[model samples]
Target: MPLTFEDLLARARALPRLGHRALLGIAGSPGAGKSTLAEQLVRTLNGEGEPWVAHVPMDGFHLADVELDRLGRRDRKGAPDTFDAAGYAALLRRLREERDEGGEVVYAPGFERVLEQPLAGAIAVPPTARLVVTEGNYLLLDTGAWSRVRAQLDEVWFCAPDEDERVRRLVARHEEFGKSHQEAVAWVLRSDERNARLVAATRERADLVVRDLVGWPDRHGRPRTGGEPGPVGTDTGC
Candidate 1:
Protein backbone atom coordinates (compact mmCIF):
# COMPACT_ATOMS: atom_id res chain seq x y z
CA MET A 1 0.00 0.00 0.00
CA PRO A 2 1.13 3.56 -0.70
CA LEU A 3 1.73 5.93 2.21
CA THR A 4 -0.14 9.19 2.34
CA PHE A 5 1.76 12.50 2.51
CA GLU A 6 0.60 13.01 6.09
CA ASP A 7 1.82 9.55 7.00
CA LEU A 8 5.24 10.40 5.63
CA LEU A 9 5.30 13.63 7.61
CA ALA A 10 4.43 11.83 10.82
CA ARG A 11 7.29 9.42 10.15
CA ALA A 12 9.68 12.34 9.75
CA ARG A 13 8.48 13.97 12.96
CA ALA A 14 9.17 10.81 14.90
CA LEU A 15 12.83 10.58 13.88
CA PRO A 16 14.16 13.60 15.77
CA ARG A 17 13.68 12.12 19.26
CA LEU A 18 15.98 9.25 18.34
CA GLY A 19 19.05 11.32 19.40
CA HIS A 20 20.60 11.82 15.97
CA ARG A 21 19.78 13.98 12.97
CA ALA A 22 17.30 12.36 10.62
CA LEU A 23 18.35 12.12 7.00
CA LEU A 24 15.32 11.51 4.80
CA GLY A 25 16.34 10.81 1.24
CA ILE A 26 14.04 11.63 -1.63
CA ALA A 27 15.37 10.03 -4.80
CA GLY A 28 14.04 9.14 -8.23
CA SER A 29 14.87 9.32 -11.93
CA PRO A 30 15.05 12.61 -13.77
CA GLY A 31 11.83 14.63 -13.71
CA ALA A 32 10.36 12.26 -11.15
CA GLY A 33 9.30 15.28 -9.05
CA LYS A 34 11.86 14.67 -6.33
CA SER A 35 12.62 18.35 -5.82
CA THR A 36 9.00 19.37 -6.01
CA LEU A 37 7.97 16.79 -3.47
CA ALA A 38 10.85 17.65 -1.17
CA GLU A 39 9.84 21.30 -1.26
CA GLN A 40 6.24 20.44 -0.50
CA LEU A 41 7.25 18.24 2.39
CA VAL A 42 9.41 20.93 3.91
CA ARG A 43 6.73 23.54 3.45
CA THR A 44 4.10 21.34 5.00
CA LEU A 45 6.33 20.47 7.93
CA ASN A 46 7.36 24.04 8.57
CA GLY A 47 4.11 25.76 7.73
CA GLU A 48 3.64 26.55 11.39
CA GLY A 49 6.93 28.52 11.17
CA GLU A 50 8.99 26.35 13.47
CA PRO A 51 11.60 25.68 10.75
CA TRP A 52 12.53 22.27 12.08
CA VAL A 53 13.66 20.83 8.74
CA ALA A 54 16.18 21.78 6.06
CA HIS A 55 16.64 20.48 2.50
CA VAL A 56 20.03 19.43 1.20
CA PRO A 57 19.77 18.56 -2.46
CA MET A 58 22.40 16.40 -4.15
CA ASP A 59 22.17 18.56 -7.27
CA GLY A 60 23.90 21.26 -5.23
CA PHE A 61 27.06 19.18 -5.29
CA HIS A 62 27.33 18.96 -9.06
CA LEU A 63 30.73 19.90 -10.41
CA ALA A 64 30.97 23.24 -12.19
CA ASP A 65 30.40 23.36 -15.95
CA VAL A 66 34.00 24.31 -16.71
CA GLU A 67 35.13 21.30 -14.72
CA LEU A 68 32.78 19.05 -16.67
CA ASP A 69 33.98 20.54 -19.96
CA ARG A 70 37.55 20.10 -18.83
CA LEU A 71 36.88 16.46 -18.08
CA GLY A 72 35.06 16.07 -21.41
CA ARG A 73 31.82 15.10 -19.68
CA ARG A 74 29.59 18.00 -20.71
CA ASP A 75 27.39 15.66 -22.69
CA ARG A 76 26.71 13.69 -19.50
CA LYS A 77 26.09 16.52 -17.10
CA GLY A 78 23.58 14.69 -14.89
CA ALA A 79 25.53 11.43 -14.63
CA PRO A 80 26.66 10.32 -11.19
CA ASP A 81 30.28 11.01 -12.02
CA THR A 82 29.40 14.62 -12.73
CA PHE A 83 28.77 15.34 -9.02
CA ASP A 84 30.92 15.69 -5.91
CA ALA A 85 29.34 12.75 -4.15
CA ALA A 86 32.17 12.36 -1.69
CA GLY A 87 31.83 15.94 -0.55
CA TYR A 88 28.11 15.47 -0.14
CA ALA A 89 28.64 12.36 1.96
CA ALA A 90 31.09 14.23 4.13
CA LEU A 91 28.59 17.04 4.72
CA LEU A 92 25.91 14.58 5.67
CA ARG A 93 28.22 13.08 8.21
CA ARG A 94 28.90 16.52 9.65
CA LEU A 95 25.23 17.37 9.80
CA ARG A 96 24.61 14.21 11.77
CA GLU A 97 27.48 14.48 14.25
CA GLU A 98 27.83 18.15 15.08
CA ARG A 99 25.85 19.23 18.09
CA ASP A 100 23.82 22.39 17.86
CA GLU A 101 25.76 25.32 19.31
CA GLY A 102 22.84 27.71 19.38
CA GLY A 103 23.66 30.17 16.55
CA GLU A 104 26.36 28.23 14.74
CA VAL A 105 25.60 27.54 11.10
CA VAL A 106 27.17 25.13 8.62
CA TYR A 107 27.59 26.15 5.04
CA ALA A 108 26.98 23.72 2.21
CA PRO A 109 27.10 23.76 -1.59
CA GLY A 110 24.39 24.64 -4.13
CA PHE A 111 24.13 24.30 -7.91
CA GLU A 112 23.18 27.05 -10.33
CA ARG A 113 21.55 25.79 -13.49
CA VAL A 114 21.56 29.07 -15.38
CA LEU A 115 25.26 29.62 -14.70
CA GLU A 116 26.01 25.94 -15.07
CA GLN A 117 28.23 26.04 -12.00
CA PRO A 118 28.33 25.00 -8.36
CA LEU A 119 28.11 27.87 -5.92
CA ALA A 120 30.12 27.25 -2.80
CA GLY A 121 28.53 27.89 0.61
CA ALA A 122 25.21 28.70 -0.96
CA ILE A 123 23.20 26.55 1.52
CA ALA A 124 23.31 26.90 5.24
CA VAL A 125 22.30 24.05 7.53
CA PRO A 126 21.67 25.55 10.92
CA PRO A 127 22.72 23.80 14.11
CA THR A 128 19.18 23.67 15.44
CA ALA A 129 17.70 21.67 12.58
CA ARG A 130 16.66 18.13 13.45
CA LEU A 131 15.57 16.82 10.05
CA VAL A 132 17.80 17.09 7.02
CA VAL A 133 15.90 16.06 3.89
CA THR A 134 18.18 15.43 0.94
CA GLU A 135 16.93 14.74 -2.56
CA GLY A 136 18.84 13.70 -5.65
CA ASN A 137 19.18 11.19 -8.46
CA TYR A 138 21.76 8.71 -7.15
CA LEU A 139 20.90 8.32 -3.46
CA LEU A 140 19.96 4.68 -3.87
CA LEU A 141 22.35 3.72 -6.63
CA ASP A 142 24.29 0.59 -5.63
CA THR A 143 27.73 1.35 -7.05
CA GLY A 144 30.60 3.78 -6.65
CA ALA A 145 30.11 7.01 -4.66
CA TRP A 146 26.37 6.59 -4.89
CA SER A 147 26.54 3.39 -2.87
CA ARG A 148 27.56 5.32 0.22
CA VAL A 149 24.74 7.85 -0.06
CA ARG A 150 21.98 5.55 1.17
CA ALA A 151 23.84 4.31 4.23
CA GLN A 152 23.81 7.84 5.62
CA LEU A 153 20.07 8.25 5.37
CA ASP A 154 17.62 7.30 8.12
CA GLU A 155 14.97 6.62 5.48
CA VAL A 156 14.69 6.87 1.70
CA TRP A 157 11.61 7.49 -0.42
CA PHE A 158 11.44 6.77 -4.12
CA CYS A 159 8.93 8.94 -5.99
CA ALA A 160 7.37 7.34 -9.07
CA PRO A 161 4.85 8.87 -11.48
CA ASP A 162 3.01 7.70 -14.58
CA GLU A 163 5.34 7.04 -17.52
CA ASP A 164 3.68 9.20 -20.16
CA GLU A 165 3.17 12.01 -17.67
CA ARG A 166 6.80 11.80 -16.56
CA VAL A 167 8.02 12.01 -20.16
CA ARG A 168 5.75 14.97 -20.81
CA ARG A 169 7.06 16.72 -17.71
CA LEU A 170 10.65 16.04 -18.73
CA VAL A 171 10.11 17.40 -22.20
CA ALA A 172 8.45 20.47 -20.79
CA ARG A 173 11.25 20.98 -18.27
CA HIS A 174 13.85 20.72 -21.02
CA GLU A 175 12.05 23.29 -23.11
CA GLU A 176 11.72 25.59 -20.12
CA PHE A 177 15.44 25.25 -19.51
CA GLY A 178 16.28 26.57 -22.97
CA LYS A 179 16.59 23.34 -24.91
CA SER A 180 15.04 23.27 -28.34
CA HIS A 181 12.15 20.83 -28.76
CA GLN A 182 14.31 18.47 -30.84
CA GLU A 183 17.18 18.79 -28.39
CA ALA A 184 14.85 18.11 -25.50
CA VAL A 185 13.49 14.97 -27.11
CA ALA A 186 16.97 13.76 -27.96
CA TRP A 187 18.19 14.40 -24.43
CA VAL A 188 15.21 12.58 -22.98
CA LEU A 189 15.70 9.61 -25.30
CA ARG A 190 19.44 9.49 -24.80
CA SER A 191 20.74 10.84 -21.49
CA ASP A 192 17.54 10.94 -19.44
CA GLU A 193 16.45 7.46 -20.48
CA ARG A 194 19.78 5.98 -19.47
CA ASN A 195 19.58 7.53 -16.01
CA ALA A 196 15.94 6.50 -15.73
CA ARG A 197 16.82 2.86 -16.18
CA LEU A 198 19.47 3.09 -13.51
CA VAL A 199 17.08 4.80 -11.06
CA ALA A 200 14.24 2.33 -11.64
CA ALA A 201 16.46 -0.56 -10.64
CA THR A 202 16.77 0.93 -7.13
CA ARG A 203 13.07 1.10 -6.30
CA GLU A 204 13.07 -2.22 -4.49
CA ARG A 205 15.70 -0.78 -2.16
CA ALA A 206 13.57 2.16 -1.11
CA ASP A 207 11.90 2.25 2.31
CA LEU A 208 8.85 3.95 0.79
CA VAL A 209 7.59 4.61 -2.71
CA VAL A 210 5.68 7.86 -3.28
CA ARG A 211 3.06 8.48 -5.94
CA ASP A 212 2.63 11.81 -7.66
CA LEU A 213 -0.09 14.19 -6.60
CA VAL A 214 -3.41 13.91 -8.45
CA GLY A 215 -6.40 16.24 -8.61
CA TRP A 216 -10.10 16.02 -9.45
CA PRO A 217 -11.16 12.54 -10.53
CA ASP A 218 -11.35 10.16 -13.46
CA ARG A 219 -14.46 9.94 -15.64
CA HIS A 220 -16.58 9.41 -12.52
CA GLY A 221 -15.32 12.52 -10.68
CA ARG A 222 -14.50 10.53 -7.56
CA PRO A 223 -11.59 11.83 -5.44
CA ARG A 224 -8.48 9.78 -6.13
CA THR A 225 -5.81 8.72 -3.69
CA GLY A 226 -2.41 10.20 -4.56
CA GLY A 227 -0.58 7.14 -3.25
CA GLU A 228 -1.37 4.21 -5.58
CA PRO A 229 -1.67 5.61 -9.06
CA GLY A 230 0.30 3.87 -11.79
CA PRO A 231 3.80 2.90 -12.80
CA VAL A 232 5.82 5.77 -14.18
CA GLY A 233 9.16 5.83 -15.96
CA THR A 234 11.86 6.25 -13.32
CA ASP A 235 13.58 9.12 -15.06
CA THR A 236 14.73 12.12 -12.95
CA GLY A 237 16.70 13.86 -15.68
CA CYS A 238 17.54 17.02 -13.74
Candidate 2:
Protein backbone atom coordinates (compact mmCIF):
# COMPACT_ATOMS: atom_id res chain seq x y z
CA MET A 1 0.00 0.00 0.00
CA PRO A 2 1.09 3.56 -0.71
CA LEU A 3 2.34 5.41 2.39
CA THR A 4 0.33 8.40 3.56
CA PHE A 5 1.39 11.65 5.28
CA GLU A 6 -0.40 10.64 8.48
CA ASP A 7 1.61 7.43 8.58
CA LEU A 8 4.83 9.40 8.40
CA LEU A 9 3.61 11.80 11.08
CA ALA A 10 2.75 8.96 13.43
CA ARG A 11 6.23 7.53 13.00
CA ALA A 12 7.77 10.92 13.84
CA ARG A 13 5.62 11.32 16.95
CA ALA A 14 7.04 8.11 18.35
CA LEU A 15 10.68 9.22 18.09
CA PRO A 16 10.69 11.45 21.16
CA ARG A 17 9.32 8.67 23.31
CA LEU A 18 12.34 6.45 22.62
CA GLY A 19 14.35 7.26 25.79
CA HIS A 20 16.72 9.92 24.44
CA ARG A 21 16.81 12.76 21.96
CA ALA A 22 16.35 11.19 18.52
CA LEU A 23 17.80 12.13 15.19
CA LEU A 24 15.97 11.19 12.00
CA GLY A 25 17.76 11.37 8.69
CA ILE A 26 15.89 11.88 5.43
CA ALA A 27 17.96 10.78 2.45
CA GLY A 28 17.43 11.12 -1.28
CA SER A 29 18.72 12.56 -4.51
CA PRO A 30 18.79 16.31 -5.04
CA GLY A 31 15.08 16.58 -5.78
CA ALA A 32 13.53 13.54 -4.14
CA GLY A 33 11.62 15.61 -1.55
CA LYS A 34 13.92 14.79 1.37
CA SER A 35 13.82 18.35 2.63
CA THR A 36 10.09 18.61 2.10
CA LEU A 37 9.45 15.50 4.13
CA ALA A 38 11.79 16.53 6.94
CA GLU A 39 10.42 20.06 7.02
CA GLN A 40 6.79 18.99 7.07
CA LEU A 41 7.39 16.41 9.73
CA VAL A 42 9.14 18.92 11.94
CA ARG A 43 6.59 21.64 11.29
CA THR A 44 3.54 19.49 11.84
CA LEU A 45 4.96 17.70 14.86
CA ASN A 46 5.57 20.97 16.66
CA GLY A 47 2.34 22.71 15.72
CA GLU A 48 0.71 24.85 18.44
CA GLY A 49 3.21 23.64 20.93
CA GLU A 50 6.45 24.37 22.73
CA PRO A 51 8.51 23.07 19.78
CA TRP A 52 9.93 19.65 20.53
CA VAL A 53 11.27 19.04 17.03
CA ALA A 54 14.24 20.62 15.26
CA HIS A 55 15.46 20.60 11.64
CA VAL A 56 19.06 20.69 10.45
CA PRO A 57 19.86 19.94 6.83
CA MET A 58 23.18 18.47 5.72
CA ASP A 59 23.37 21.10 3.00
CA GLY A 60 24.61 23.33 5.80
CA PHE A 61 27.83 21.34 5.82
CA HIS A 62 28.50 22.18 2.18
CA LEU A 63 32.03 23.48 1.80
CA ALA A 64 32.06 27.10 0.76
CA ASP A 65 32.32 27.86 -2.97
CA VAL A 66 35.74 29.42 -2.44
CA GLU A 67 36.93 26.24 -0.76
CA LEU A 68 35.51 24.21 -3.62
CA ASP A 69 37.29 26.42 -6.14
CA ARG A 70 40.52 26.08 -4.18
CA LEU A 71 40.23 22.31 -4.41
CA GLY A 72 39.17 22.57 -8.07
CA ARG A 73 35.83 20.89 -7.39
CA ARG A 74 33.54 23.83 -8.08
CA ASP A 75 31.79 22.09 -10.94
CA ARG A 76 30.90 19.18 -8.68
CA LYS A 77 29.62 21.35 -5.88
CA GLY A 78 27.06 18.85 -4.66
CA ALA A 79 29.37 15.86 -4.59
CA PRO A 80 30.18 14.01 -1.39
CA ASP A 81 33.68 15.44 -1.05
CA THR A 82 32.28 18.91 -1.70
CA PHE A 83 31.08 18.90 1.94
CA ASP A 84 32.75 18.56 5.32
CA ALA A 85 31.67 14.99 5.92
CA ALA A 86 33.63 14.42 9.10
CA GLY A 87 32.46 17.72 10.55
CA TYR A 88 28.85 16.92 9.77
CA ALA A 89 29.16 13.56 11.45
CA ALA A 90 30.72 15.17 14.45
CA LEU A 91 27.91 17.70 14.70
CA LEU A 92 25.37 14.92 14.58
CA ARG A 93 27.14 13.10 17.35
CA ARG A 94 27.24 16.25 19.45
CA LEU A 95 23.59 16.98 18.81
CA ARG A 96 22.60 13.51 19.88
CA GLU A 97 24.61 13.69 23.09
CA GLU A 98 23.85 17.25 24.05
CA ARG A 99 20.50 17.94 25.68
CA ASP A 100 18.90 20.55 27.89
CA GLU A 101 21.21 19.35 30.63
CA GLY A 102 22.96 22.68 30.85
CA GLY A 103 20.11 24.61 29.32
CA GLU A 104 22.48 25.73 26.54
CA VAL A 105 21.30 26.15 22.96
CA VAL A 106 22.76 24.13 20.11
CA TYR A 107 23.33 26.09 16.94
CA ALA A 108 23.61 24.60 13.45
CA PRO A 109 24.62 26.11 10.17
CA GLY A 110 22.17 26.69 7.35
CA PHE A 111 22.70 26.83 3.59
CA GLU A 112 21.64 29.86 1.58
CA ARG A 113 20.31 28.87 -1.82
CA VAL A 114 20.67 32.36 -3.23
CA LEU A 115 24.17 33.12 -1.97
CA GLU A 116 25.21 29.48 -2.13
CA GLN A 117 27.01 29.69 1.20
CA PRO A 118 26.88 27.90 4.51
CA LEU A 119 25.82 30.25 7.26
CA ALA A 120 27.08 29.29 10.68
CA GLY A 121 24.90 29.38 13.79
CA ALA A 122 21.80 29.79 11.68
CA ILE A 123 19.55 27.16 13.31
CA ALA A 124 19.09 26.66 16.99
CA VAL A 125 18.06 23.30 18.40
CA PRO A 126 16.40 24.24 21.62
CA PRO A 127 17.04 22.47 24.91
CA THR A 128 13.49 21.18 24.93
CA ALA A 129 13.82 19.78 21.43
CA ARG A 130 13.79 16.00 21.54
CA LEU A 131 13.71 15.20 17.85
CA VAL A 132 16.13 16.43 15.23
CA VAL A 133 15.15 15.93 11.59
CA THR A 134 17.97 16.20 9.07
CA GLU A 135 17.76 15.71 5.30
CA GLY A 136 20.56 15.16 2.83
CA ASN A 137 21.77 13.21 -0.22
CA TYR A 138 24.57 11.07 1.22
CA LEU A 139 23.04 10.07 4.56
CA LEU A 140 22.89 6.41 3.58
CA LEU A 141 26.15 6.28 1.65
CA ASP A 142 28.70 3.91 3.20
CA THR A 143 31.68 5.36 1.43
CA GLY A 144 34.45 7.12 3.33
CA ALA A 145 33.43 9.41 6.20
CA TRP A 146 29.83 9.39 5.08
CA SER A 147 29.49 6.00 6.75
CA ARG A 148 29.84 7.72 10.09
CA VAL A 149 26.65 9.68 9.51
CA ARG A 150 24.30 6.74 9.82
CA ALA A 151 25.61 5.80 13.25
CA GLN A 152 24.46 9.14 14.57
CA LEU A 153 20.99 8.93 13.12
CA ASP A 154 18.45 6.77 14.92
CA GLU A 155 16.69 6.07 11.62
CA VAL A 156 17.02 7.22 8.05
CA TRP A 157 14.15 7.48 5.56
CA PHE A 158 14.77 7.65 1.82
CA CYS A 159 12.54 9.65 -0.49
CA ALA A 160 11.78 8.34 -3.97
CA PRO A 161 9.39 10.27 -6.20
CA ASP A 162 8.43 9.78 -9.83
CA GLU A 163 11.37 10.30 -12.18
CA ASP A 164 9.87 13.26 -14.05
CA GLU A 165 8.73 15.06 -10.92
CA ARG A 166 12.20 14.66 -9.42
CA VAL A 167 13.82 16.32 -12.41
CA ARG A 168 11.29 19.15 -12.54
CA ARG A 169 11.70 19.94 -8.82
CA LEU A 170 15.48 19.85 -9.14
CA VAL A 171 15.46 22.20 -12.10
CA ALA A 172 13.02 24.58 -10.47
CA ARG A 173 15.18 24.62 -7.32
CA HIS A 174 18.22 25.64 -9.34
CA GLU A 175 16.32 28.42 -11.07
CA GLU A 176 14.89 29.65 -7.80
CA PHE A 177 18.37 29.72 -6.33
CA GLY A 178 19.70 32.12 -8.96
CA LYS A 179 20.29 30.09 -12.10
CA SER A 180 18.64 30.83 -15.40
CA HIS A 181 16.25 28.22 -16.78
CA GLN A 182 18.83 27.10 -19.33
CA GLU A 183 21.55 26.93 -16.71
CA ALA A 184 19.28 25.06 -14.35
CA VAL A 185 18.47 22.48 -16.99
CA ALA A 186 22.12 22.10 -17.84
CA TRP A 187 23.19 21.63 -14.22
CA VAL A 188 20.42 19.15 -13.53
CA LEU A 189 21.50 17.07 -16.51
CA ARG A 190 25.24 17.31 -16.08
CA SER A 191 25.68 17.37 -12.31
CA ASP A 192 22.51 16.72 -10.32
CA GLU A 193 21.67 13.53 -12.25
CA ARG A 194 24.95 11.91 -11.30
CA ASN A 195 24.36 12.67 -7.62
CA ALA A 196 20.83 11.40 -8.06
CA ARG A 197 22.08 8.06 -9.27
CA LEU A 198 24.45 7.78 -6.36
CA VAL A 199 21.71 8.66 -3.89
CA ALA A 200 19.31 6.19 -5.51
CA ALA A 201 21.83 3.44 -4.95
CA THR A 202 21.74 4.12 -1.21
CA ARG A 203 17.96 3.85 -0.96
CA GLU A 204 18.13 0.18 -0.03
CA ARG A 205 20.08 1.10 3.11
CA ALA A 206 17.44 3.45 4.50
CA ASP A 207 15.07 2.33 7.28
CA LEU A 208 12.07 3.43 5.19
CA VAL A 209 11.21 4.53 1.66
CA VAL A 210 8.80 7.50 1.42
CA ARG A 211 6.95 8.00 -1.89
CA ASP A 212 3.91 10.29 -1.62
CA LEU A 213 5.01 13.85 -0.82
CA VAL A 214 3.07 16.26 -3.09
CA GLY A 215 1.80 19.69 -4.27
CA TRP A 216 4.25 20.49 -7.04
CA PRO A 217 2.65 21.73 -10.27
CA ASP A 218 3.57 19.91 -13.46
CA ARG A 219 4.97 21.53 -16.60
CA HIS A 220 1.47 22.06 -18.00
CA GLY A 221 -0.10 22.81 -14.61
CA ARG A 222 -1.46 19.26 -14.50
CA PRO A 223 -0.78 16.79 -11.70
CA ARG A 224 2.35 14.73 -12.32
CA THR A 225 1.94 11.55 -10.27
CA GLY A 226 -1.55 10.50 -11.33
CA GLY A 227 -4.44 11.85 -9.26
CA GLU A 228 -3.19 10.87 -5.80
CA PRO A 229 -2.64 14.56 -5.25
CA GLY A 230 -4.12 17.36 -7.31
CA PRO A 231 -2.49 20.63 -8.26
CA VAL A 232 -1.83 22.90 -5.27
CA GLY A 233 1.28 24.97 -5.49
CA THR A 234 5.08 24.75 -5.71
CA ASP A 235 7.14 22.11 -3.94
CA THR A 236 9.55 22.75 -1.08
CA GLY A 237 12.68 21.81 -3.02
CA CYS A 238 15.00 19.82 -0.74
The prediction achieving the highest lDDT against the true structure is: 2
The sequence of per-residue lDDT tens digits that candidate 1 reaches over residues 1-238 is: 4445566667778877545678899888898878777876777777767788998889889888889999999999898889988888888888877666544687888877667678889989887788989998889898877777888888888888877778888998899878999999999998998988888998888887776545323223244565423222232222
**lDDT of the candidates, in the order given:** 0.78, 0.82
Model 2: per-residue Cα lDDT over 51-119, one tens digit each = 899999999999999999999999999999999999999999998987666756889999998899999
Q: How far does residue 215 in candidate 1 sit from its true spot (Å)?
A: 4.4
The C-alpha TM-scores of every prediction are: 0.87, 0.88
Error of 1 at 11 (Å): 1.6
Instruction: State, as a TM-score between 0 and 1, how close model 2 is to the true structure.
Output: 0.88
* Clash totals in order: 7, 0
True-structure lDDT of candidate 2: 0.82
Instruction: Give the clashing residue pairs of candidate 1, or none.
Output: 29-235, 29-236, 30-235, 30-236, 30-237, 31-236, 31-237
Model 2: CA > 4 A from native: 212-238
